[model samples]
Target chain A: MNTYDLIIVGAGPGGSVAAKIAAEKGLKTVFFERGRKPGEKNSSGCGLGPRMFRDFPEMMKKLTPEKCHSMRAGVAARNYFVNKDDIVAGYIMARPTESVSYEPAKSWITMNVYRSEFDPWIAEFATDAGAELKTSTLIIDLLKENGKVSGVIDDKGEKYKAPIVIGADGAVSTVAQKSGLRSKWSQNQVTLTLQYDFQAPSEKIDDIMGDETLAVWWGSNFPASYQVFFNDGFHQGLGNWMTWWDKTPLFYLNRVVNLKYYQRLLKILDAKPRELQAHLLPWLDYPYNTYTDGIILIGDAGGFPCPLEAEGIYPAMVTGKIAAEVAAEAVSSGDFSKESLKKFDEGWKKTSIGEEFEAGAELWNIWKALPFSPKETMSWFVPMIMEILGGIFDWSQPHGKRVRQIISHVKSYMPKATPFIMKNVFPLVAKIFEDDLDKIMDPKKIMKVLPKLLDMLPQKKKRRGSQEK
Target chain B: MKIELEGLTKRIPGTGEFISINSLKCNNCDRCLFVCVMNLWRKKEGKIYLAEDYQSKCLECAACFQVCDAGAIMFKYPAGGTGIVIEKG
Candidate 1:
């Protein structure tokens, strides 16, 4: 049996961060990943926030020029069609500031990265800090001794022992399950999202997207939830909710609806789709306890993926760092019990995760209730929310001012005509401030309850297929 | 050749789940090939191909299939005793 002070499963942002922090603190940390390399199995339209640079300054210092790609500004555009053939588009632009510098084309600077390049770059920081990384290895089970998690068992029946185990294995977390930290997630608690990365010629991309701004297209035709993101040059990623697939018999029908919408977009840009890739993203909605005796879950394993934006990289890294802090404290104390690890859970909820989810859940519910047309939602609701937030709160302000502004904005939006926002929104937002305000001050509560309210809203029936095996 | 698209929809090689591809809707953009961490997509001449060459390397993250825009890349859990077999280090 191999032993270590801490063992982290999965080498995505979460696992790697945890390993780096633990190793830097002089703990014997060993990280395991099933992928051939750190970022090999990971993919995302990631927005690496500035706060990450503040938290992990050392890791940032290690970033080589090849590893970082910069974006200048962020634009949210909507394509509205008068008919199946004729479409009009509009956009909203925002400049990045000191606090929110990661938006595309911001003067403060933000970078877009290929996970394949980014994950290993960060993992190297951990290895340099003396953490052992085991790649191409699958962790099959949790070694439970006397009803407590002792370590992990790999497929080869080799048991690696550790005082603590951190599950950062992503949304479909094997470590979380094997360690008995969480039950199988409910569909409602998860959002199945699919995205596409289209490769185009650089000049074509520059002509279509222009220079260095991230462009987002919302409310095209698929649903109120559709978004297409343009990154770097020639790379565009589009995503839509998968729940809609249940309503129609033909899976491709959903794609057709999206494609038709994009066809109009293609005309606008005079560009064609070049390599299209799709993926299902598990967005966490409901809160699940993410810690157990000798075990803790971080990143997607803890359901920390931002439910609204589907952004996980920053939060994953943040949570991983927090988890490592807790693990270090536990290891120094020579104890790895649920009670010892409770600080991680408590600390996480106190941070941005709780508030972000609350806001995301509320936003999801309101969006779900809006008519299925993406055009209407994007044209009216999405911008309305952003404008409202921009008006009430300034992202460049201090944390206190931001919180106050968020509260004021929520109060204002609560009475709006959108029943989903009015009914499900305020209560969820209130929850974020009501109980956890001292520990965490996030405006995300308003976003959490929207889905449940949407479920209550009368909607169309779904067609069943020969049930998926 | 009589081709039942429905038959192709059943069973995702290793896992006991049915994965299907709407071949008619497939645009062959090859996005899944780029996103697949295992390099499961191969290019034959001008067309895109899906192979299991590095299938054993798949962590089942589903990033490739999730990023397929045309619904062309379908996944069926591999049959019993077949698919990416992972080993411990």
Candidate 2:
């Protein structure tokens, strides 16, 4: 048995980060990668969020000009909403930096990185920190001692012993499966993604994508949303909910790539895919199991992928650090039990990673659980919501009539209009807008609109009479 | 139309066949068909099966194993360097 203070499976961001931290703490750590190289089997074109710089500044020093593309500070959040025919339905561009009410100092800056270059770099950081990395070593299962995880066994039937093991083995983690810590993710919990890496000239990518801004497209025709990030070239991909498919992702990909909108962009970049990559990543609705006795799961294996954007690099690194912090304490105390590792669970939740996942889950459920299928949700609900919000500030309509129009629209679309109106929507709206309502109710604001409101009263009464009849 | 992934080859030979579905436990919910990006799974004669020896096209994301509620899917990654590899990744 090869023994170490800690053993980590999978040399992706999670395992590498854990190894770096543990080794920094003077704990002997060994991390294993199944691929011939650290990132040989990993996904590419990840967006490392602002939290990456905040949490791991040392890792930032490791980023290279070739491996990473530092997104600009002024890059705004831009969303292009496409309809069934690939027509742009609505566009939203918000410059967080320009918002007076928003604090620019706390804004997030995203970095685009290819895992092939990024993973090997991070793994090298761990090695430089005195951690041992065994490449091309496939960890098949966890080694158990009296029903508690003691270490992991690689493909050659060789067992490596450690007081603790961290499973960072991406989505299909063998350690999580074999230890029975978690065997499989439900369809709803994970998503299937397929991405194409296009090799374009740096000048072309900059010209087409505005140098630093990232762009996202949401449409009914797309299996899921599509994203484009700039690396040396362009990384464009689509991911759909695992169980929401009417056709295979490939079918959707073919359709999306040929769309007029995509075709125009492709033309600009002279789109020729250098490679195609596919992956399964968790989109945890809420926090799921991540830690166990003598073993902790991090990154995709632990279901820490950010829910809203399905971005995994930040959560993986953040949780990796948190796990290492907890593991270092556990090793120092000579306690490798579940109770000792529970601190990772509590500690991670309090961090930005936990907050992002929790908030992302709420946003996902609101979009997913709407009383419509995925297609309808995008085609009908999203555009309608955007239009309604757009109408709120439409100066052409009287404010009073606009309010009535918004109420009518809500009632028309809701599945059970009466109960939804009476039980939830009305009370929540009233509570939220109570102060604004008092201002609007002022005789001054209403005086100008009284004639317009009174003129509409007969029509409203006639409509009510028909309903009652 | 199937998009030709030129220069695409198995990372290692004969590894894609490791994942399979057990017929006894599968209730033919067609979840596998929905989840597989390669279109490798299909329902035939009221039974579900892989449409072809198509695992080489698999991304090996384990969506099939995870999505199958019937516990009918048996998933194991192909031997190291034997399945798909994203060279640019």
Candidate 3:
């Protein structure tokens, strides 16, 4: 038996981060990777969310330009919601807003990174912290001692012993299965997405998708997809709920790439197919069975991917650190009971994971449980929004028409967006886009429509207004 | 403008064996067919089966295993260093 104080399966963000923290705490740690290198078998093109820098404040200063090239591309949160026919329905350009805490988080929505380069870069920290990394090994299952997890067994049937094991083997986690956490995620809990990596000159990517910005496409016909521009390449990824797909993702990808929107982008970049791959993500909400005796699941294995955007790296790293601290305490105390490991659960609650995942779950469910399917919501929302914006912005439309467009669609959006509307958020958005409408706010026209808008309000408010009249 | 899926979906040998359907458990709901990103699950003569070149075509994300209600599909990541290498995800 190969014995270590801690055993970690998968060299992903979660596992590697755990290894680093555990080793730094003076516990002997060994992490396994299925790839020949740290991240070759792993996926690439990830957005290390703002929380990463917030948590590891020293990480920014630690990265020497020579150490990591992928990260030097800088940070951006320029998001685009693309509609059917590849039209951009909405665009959000990120800049500093009100902030006293975590200043980098203001402009840095996410730092785009290629896992092939980024994973190895992070994993090196674990090794430098005195953790051992075994590459090209798969921990097929968890080893048990009297119904308690003792460690993991690799594919060749070699058993490694430890008092604690962190299951970071991703969404399709083997440790999760053998430990009886789950056989696999159900259709509702996980989404499978396919990505096409198109390699291009660095200049080409910067010229097109903007070196810093990443775009996501959502539509009735196309489903959910993204184009993320990195240093040497960009990834066009397509995805949907696992159970709702009536056809393969490839079926829709073929149709989408044919549209003029993508054609012009591809032709300009002169991109070539570098790799086609897919990833499974735990999406809907968080998982209940994330921790047990002598075992803790982190990352997608623990169902920690973000509900809104499906980003896993941040939650994974956060949980990984918390789990490692709990693991170290357990090993030192010789108490590997589930109660002792509850710290992993309690610790993440104090961090941004709970706030992010909880709010994100509500926002995500609004899309999933909408009056329309995810596909229909995209089609319904985008065109309506685009028409209203076009009505207001385009000079071709008469002022009356723009006002009519705004009033007509006002009924569609107000109910859906109001409850969670941040203070001034809606008004700012309305103000920014309604400049043309502000000019055309004819009082007589407002008075005519105002009565109808007041009627749409509750009868009690209308009665109060009628008394004033 | 037109992207070809044929040349894009690539794979190394041996990982296709990672996912197999258990005969007795299979109810043939064909759910796997709908969920597969690569469309590697095919129906031939009243049976749902892994396509012949599944090893080459399968991206190995295991959407099939997730959606299968009958617990018929068995999936594992292939032995270390022998499966699909995701360049960017």
Candidate 4:
């Protein structure tokens, strides 16, 4: 019988952040993790943006040379045909400054850390902030009283009571289900992903991936997915997403995109494929109510992953912080009702985190509609944008000039280039580039719907029939 | 090598050292067959059969193990040291 002000389940990024924030706010917080350690069961590409660290400056302060790993930089995109004949729109030899340099082009700044190291660091931050952390404990069920969650019940039948229960559990969340917050997710809402980590010599990695660029291959003869090359110290990690096998048969799909295909791509790049490990990931899209009476679901459990990029770490952290903020306020007021916890959603909406998911969903739908031809997607946009940004205008300039140039380019090109642009460029720009650009330029109105754009597609049906049942 | 079983054992499909083929639950999806790194399983008689060629090549990376939702594929650590032995990449 252990009681606390807040009990956070699943010590992933979301759980740790909630625990840390709650403990820092002087609330009695207990965090439970099923893994042997914080990140043991976690796997991700480590493509986290700098803003994640900017928000949680304490995590960065705790990062040590041994704990942190860095990639100098790498190429961003590669385009190869399904026939394996020609790499028409390849970008393996691009410079770091070409894409994301203005933000901070630290050669060794972008790191590829094993979640084994990274997750524990965040968990330790929670413990250091005075939150009690229990590992090797699986939270099997929720303890409810009068239709309100009061605590958690673990596998060993041990019960711990808390005024607020935060479910930071990953995609397959038991807490969310037991709380009657959301139903089983449909296959369409989940993206089945597979990633591989390989061990290769540093020289080999540098030779193949180039000294300064993470390579992202698209529209290759391979699956409609993205592949990343990370040079983290001694290991060169490669991760890719696979199409949903439940929708398509794996053997037919695998024959099309297997080790042979990967080997051929590596050979083209003059890189050798090594010891590989792959795992599946489930990503959510539809919004499920995340808060209820005395309980809040954060992170993947809340379906908070960015649908387009499939990035979850930053959003998980942001949502975790918001949940903790609401939990703290509720605890202080001696009220753990659903009305008080509604602030979690309100606070999350106020931040860019909520906008990221909403925009990401829209972007995902647009991407799904577009053709998966890498040559068609990149040839028109990449070179055109590169010429405009690199050849025409200098990136190192006042923000206003850059904005004016882009606006003028769009305005000038609209009349003559509308058809071609709409056919090819609109999908990529609208889906990936627009929201991110809007976030940077005007945070106030980050979501910008292209007029008459959505109407172009048939109206999507409501969640009916099998989707809901 | 074919061996006959008695009673309940006859009712159950023989389990291999590395693979546990639950012929009943398998939907012939071939997810296990395709996702296998070692190319172990194949379709025959509308069911997946573990290939002898895969005995030496199984890396034990467990990609097949994780992807198979049908519980048709299972891997136990090969007796001591008989699977994929990696030197480098």
lDDT of 1 by residue, A1-469 (tens): 7999999988888888899889989889999876567765555545565566666676775666555442222342333322222233334544454565342324433455556667878888889889999986778678878887788987657789997899988776777667766544553554444333333444555666553345444443444333333343223433344334323212322343345445655556554433222334556564577887888888888877776655777788888989999999998998887888899878877777766765666655654545344544433555455544454545577645565455444454443434554455554565646654424433355345654454443333354584767
**Quality class of the docking in candidate 2, CAPRI style:** medium
Which CAPRI category fits model 1? incorrect
Per-chain TM-score of candidate 1, chain B? 0.53
Interface RMSD of 4: 11.4
Docking class of 3: medium
DockQ of each: 0.07, 0.58, 0.71, 0.08
Write candidate 2's Cα lDDT for A173-220 as tens digits: 887888677778776777788877777776776676663456666666
Error of 1 at A418 (Å): 4.8
Tens digits of per-residue lDDT, candidate 3, A1-469, equal 7899999998987899999999999999999998787777666437776677778766545654356555534445454556655666665555445663575666656677778777888888899999999987988887888988888888888889998889998888888888887887777887777778887888776765564657656555676667776777777777767877777777776656665667777789988877787777778665579988888999888988876677788888989999989999998899999899998888887888877654554546654543115354565666656666555776666655556556666556644434323222333333445453346454456546755774554322223345663
RMSD (Å) per prediction: 14.7, 6.9, 7.3, 13.8
Top model number, TM-score: 3
Better of 2 and 3 by TM-score: 3
Residue pairs that clash (backbone atoms under 3 angstroms), model 2: B11-B81, B12-B81, B12-B82
The order by descending TM-score is 3, 2, 1, 4
Q: TM-score, B chain, candidate 4?
A: 0.67
Clashing pairs in 4: A73-A212, A73-A213, A74-A212, A74-A213, A74-A214, A75-A213, A75-A214, A82-A221
Worst 10 residues of 3 chain A by lDDT: A419-428
Q: Which candidate number has the best lDDT?
A: 3
Write the residue-wise lDDT of candidate 4 on A1-469 in tens digits: 9999999988988899999999999999999876556765565635555557667776764666455453333333343323234233333344445455433333333445556667877788899999999986778789988877889987668999987899897766768778888644554555444343444555666765564444344433333544445544322222222333333223323333354555564455554334333333445444567888988988888877776665677788999999999999998898998888899888887776767655555555545433233343433444444434453445665545565455455444334345454443444465556554444344223223432332333234454366654
Which regions of candidate 1 deviate over 4 angstroms? A61-64, A68-86, A97-110, A224-243, A247-261, A264-280, A357-361, A370-421, A424-469, B1-89
Off by over 4 Å in 3: A72-101, A367-374, A397-401, A409-451, A454-469, B6-16
